[model samples]
Every structure is written in structure tokens, then in C-alpha cells.
Target: MGMQTTPMIEMDFAVIKEDFSRYLIHDGAILKVKIVVKKILRTAELTAQGYPAGTSIDSVNAVAAIVPQALKREPSKEPWDPRRDVGEEVKFEPQEEKWQEYMTTEGYRILIKPVLTKVFRYNKYNDYGEPIYSAVIQSITNIEKLGTTATT
Candidate 1:
């Protein structure tokens, strides 16, 4: 299905300035400069990417472009942290000693204790003829839950 599009609303800045001045000021067409700036900022923010075909150009477009430009020019990621995340999945093959230790460790008690099932799948033989038991552990945390929080 195609995305839905909305027709843009045309605005007259001269009428906006007159109405704002009338509503706010008792003497003259004078609004607090900050308030005027904020109104312009909010209108541009909300109406951004909605300026349809035949929409008259104004300083609002210049204001709107600033947001995307600032986003694009955000400081690049640190060289050391390429992935920006350390969450790695739990794979059972090539299981180290700590892997089996964590299976029954107090840290994972809630997940391991609730299901209380550990079914092993023999994937392949190791170099020294030792069997590789890919332990299909029944735990919700096995996928992306590591290093987030400890059950214990």
C-alpha cells in the first residue's frame, strides 16, 4: 500500500504578525521578540516536510532546513566504538567453561530456574574428538538480554 499524504496549509506571515500583535499588545504592533521567534520556530517545526507543490517560499524554509542540516552534521561516531554496542548473542557451540558455569550461575537463576530444561544438540566433533553440545537453553535472555541486567 502507498503512504498517505496530507495537503499543506498556506499561511500569510503579515496576517500572523498583525493578529499576534493585536492579541498580545494593548498599545502597538509590538510582540515580545522572543515570543515571536518561538512562534515562528514552532510553526516551522510542525509544518516541515509538509510544504507541498506550489507552496510559496519564505524564511520558514530556511529555518526548516537548519534542523536537517544540524542532524546531518552531528559529530561522527568515535573511532574506537564502531558498533556502538557490546550486546553479543549467546552461541552454545565452542562452549567455554564460563558458558556452562553461567548456565547454572545465580546470576541467571530466574530464567534458568523457571523453565528448568536444558536440551543439548550435538553439532559436530571437536579437534580432540570431544563432542560439541549446542545447549539449546530455554531462557528469554539468551538472545539480547546479556549485560543488560542480572537476574541475581
Candidate 2:
């Protein structure tokens, strides 16, 4: 018999909201911030994924492999304020190359690709005494940033 392959299914999603945050790295010497675009799966895709009707399933593109540089920075002595240190809104848009791209108001650009990961509930076991696994779009991989790199 020939090998079986799962059919590809298109995922329909809608942008729900966006959030930004700043973090200190390298012993507080380097500052980083990233835009988290929240998206919810539509009815069709949700049903295809075996979710019940009216089930709310949300995902974000900010869960990437590489973190983006902060568009704005504050003095180390000053407490970090997200409103002032995170900079402008960044929009994540899908590209034809199968990679997602977003541009900061400062003209910096970041590229990322979606990754599907399987998660198992260790606490919950199946009748066969095996861990139950489910696939989820919880992160993105292969992140690349273009434009003037920030050093702050």
C-alpha cells in the first residue's frame, strides 16, 4: 500500500487585537520589544480543527524563534513604560512567500514563518495509558529582521 498523507487545509483567521511589551536583556544592557498580533480562528477553520461551534481559539505571531529589537528605548535608570518604550503599532501581514512580515512605525521590518507544534497533556492520559497529543499553532520560527537595526 502507498503511504498516506494528510490533506492540506487552509486556515481562516481574523485579527482580534494587538499588544506590545518591552523587556530587558543581557543584564539590562539590551532592551527588546515586540508586537503581538492576536488572531482568532474563524468558524470554518475552527470546525475543521475539530473545535465545537462558538469555541474561541486564539493564536499569536509574537511567539517566534527570534525576538525583534525594540523600536524605542528608555534610560536604564528610568522604569520601563510599555506605552513609551514599545513604540508604534506593528501590523503583521501574510506574504506570498509563505512567510509573515510586519513593519514597525519606525520602518523596521521583521519576517517570520508559522510553525505547528504538537502538545501533550502529561497530566491527562488516554484510555490506553498514553499521553494525548494535539497540534497547535502556538509559535513561529525562522525570524528575520530588516532595516536599520536598533542598538539600545
Candidate 3:
């Protein structure tokens, strides 16, 4: 039999949680943020996708492009030590845009377009000693924010 391909799927999601972390580096602070979102599957879409009725999914990580705002540098508080001197205080913020407006709200909505690809395993095997193959989300594209309530 020929190889079967997974169909492209698009889904709506609601941002449930957001976490941010900053790491001090020589140039500036590297800001990393993680966002958790839950799929908001509609009845019509679920039926179209051949999913059974009353199907539900748990929260999953959201992958999107995050453009940080302008970087600002400030004098170090403890300048006694040479390594501690220089640009020690860095402020990083998300840019004011449609995709980023969710950062200022308790909860927001988004649409995700994901591409799937097959992953080949070298050493991983199943209980039957057969090579395990799985479909993986390679990349997320065309992330759009929904609703006008988040704009204001």
C-alpha cells in the first residue's frame, strides 16, 4: 500500500496561561515566554473532522512568533564588580500588534495553522520490536488573533 498523508488541519484556541522568563547575557537579557492554550473545537468542525461526539482535549503548548519590543539598557545597581557593571537592567516587552494583544488580557483567542511531518526513529522501538513512526507538528504558521474585544 502507498503511504498515507495526514490532512492539514486548522483549529481555534483560547489562551489559558502565559509564563515569561528572562536570562541575563552579555548583550542583553534573553526573554523567553511560554503560552498554554486549549482547543475550542466547534460542533460543526468536529463533525467535519470525523471526530466522535463530546470529544475534548487538554491544554497544549502554543507555538507562535513573538516579536519583542525595543530593548532598553540601564546602569547596573552593583557597579563595584567589573563583571557586574555595564548594562545590567534590561526591559523587554511584547510589541503592540494583533497577534500580541493577548499579552495584556486575562484570556484571549487565536487560530493556529499547523503542518505535520513524519519523524523517523533510529533507536526507538515499540513493544513488538518494530521501528516507531509518528506524525509531528513541524511548524505553526498564519497565527491570527480573534475578536475585537482584545484590541481595546
Error of 1 at 81 (Å): 33
TM-score of 2: 0.23
Ten contiguous residues minimizing lDDT sum, candidate 3: 95-104
Model 3 error, position 51 (Å): 32
Candidate 2, lDDT over the whole model = 0.32
Runs with alpha carbons beyond 4 Å of true place in candidate 1: 1-116, 121-123, 140-152
Distance from true location, Cα of 15 in model 2, Å: 10
> Which 10 consecutive residues of model 1 have the lowest summed lDDT?
60-69
**RMSD to native, candidate 2:** 20.3
Model 1, residue 87: C-alpha shift (Å)? 29
User: lDDT for model 3, on a 0 to 1 scale?
Assistant: 0.31
Per residue, candidate 2 scores C-alpha lDDT tens digits across 46-112 of 2442332332223343421222233222224443343344332222222212345544332223344
Best by TM-score: 2
Candidates arranged by TM-score, highest first: 2, 3, 1
Return the TM-score for each candidate structure: 0.16, 0.23, 0.22
- Model 2 error, position 98 (Å): 2.2
